[model samples]
Target: PAPPGEGPSLERFTLAEDELRTVRLRVPEGTSGTELAALCDDLALHDWLLTTVVRMLDGLRLGAGAAQDAGTVVRTLRPAVDHLLHLWMPGARVGRELAALWDPLEERPGFTRQWQVLVQRIRDQLTLHAVPAVHREVDPAPGPPAVLPRE
Candidate 1:
């Protein structure tokens, strides 16, 4: 367990390897070609975003030397913060939400709830938009393809 007053560690934020394997197994065994393609695309996007967030947070924790850095430390934290902002600037509102989530751990002053918020937003966006977009794009047209007329 962490020292009293410290925030949860990045280990808490990680998805177990088994859980990821389970997600892989959930794809239907006999999906149609179009459905299979869409599923693959969605899985790829979901995996990429989740991995990116996890890596960023893990890097931050390592850089901060969370176990050894005295409470309220900030100097080693800037790179992690900058990386997150650069990657997610287009989703600034999401970033703000993340910061709000991480603000309560007074013992670990540099560790913020904002990281959790960022991870959640990225996951939510993947599920809500990226996956659906893949399906829409990969699914076949309802009818025959349109042919352009020669001039």
Candidate 2:
């Protein structure tokens, strides 16, 4: 294979509208089977993650009380937090020949950017829920503190 970026060329296009998203990619002529398979795996992984997160967000009822809503959100998103959050390593396994392919998708659809925003939204929800707990923990003892017999 030619040196990285010298020979291999990648073309990527994405069409995202309403409930449908389509991605098109063209890889250099000499791309190997392993590289092509790896690219497919990478793309499929992102597609699944995107779909899962969108569905999770859609199912959440944002108008519920903070603590209750947070419990629901945590319950809903637990799978993503435990199983999928750490799976965003794009191009980590792709060959040099096809690594450039991700650049176009990143430019057009901003896959990583969207994922980061979604993850942050989850964290913000959890943090917002936690604030009440923290406040309760810090509140002074109710009524009056019993006078301590001389320490």
lDDT winner: 2
With a 3 Å backbone cut-off (N, CA, C), the pairs that clash in candidate 2 are none
Model 1: CA > 4 A from native: 1-31, 62-116, 119-151
**On a 0 to 100 scale, what is the lDDT of residue 71 in model 2?**
65
Worst 10 residues of 2 by lDDT: 6-15
Whole-model Cα lDDT per candidate?
Answer: 0.40, 0.75
Candidate 1 matches the true fold with a TM-score of 0.28
- lDDT digits (tens) for residues 1-151 of candidate 2: 3455565545444446764545455554567888888977888788778778878877876645433555676788788889988999988889887788788668867888989999998777777777877887896878978997996
What lDDT score goes with residue 115 in model 1? 43
In candidate 2, stretches whose alpha carbon ends up further than 4 angstroms from where it belongs are: 1-6, 9-23, 63-68, 137-139, 142-151
In model 1, the clashing pairs are 98-114, 99-114, 101-113, 102-112, 102-113
Residue-level lDDT tens digits of model 1 in 59-144:
44333234523222233334445554444321223222122222222234222244456656444433443454567679787989
Candidate 1 lDDT at 108 equals: 42
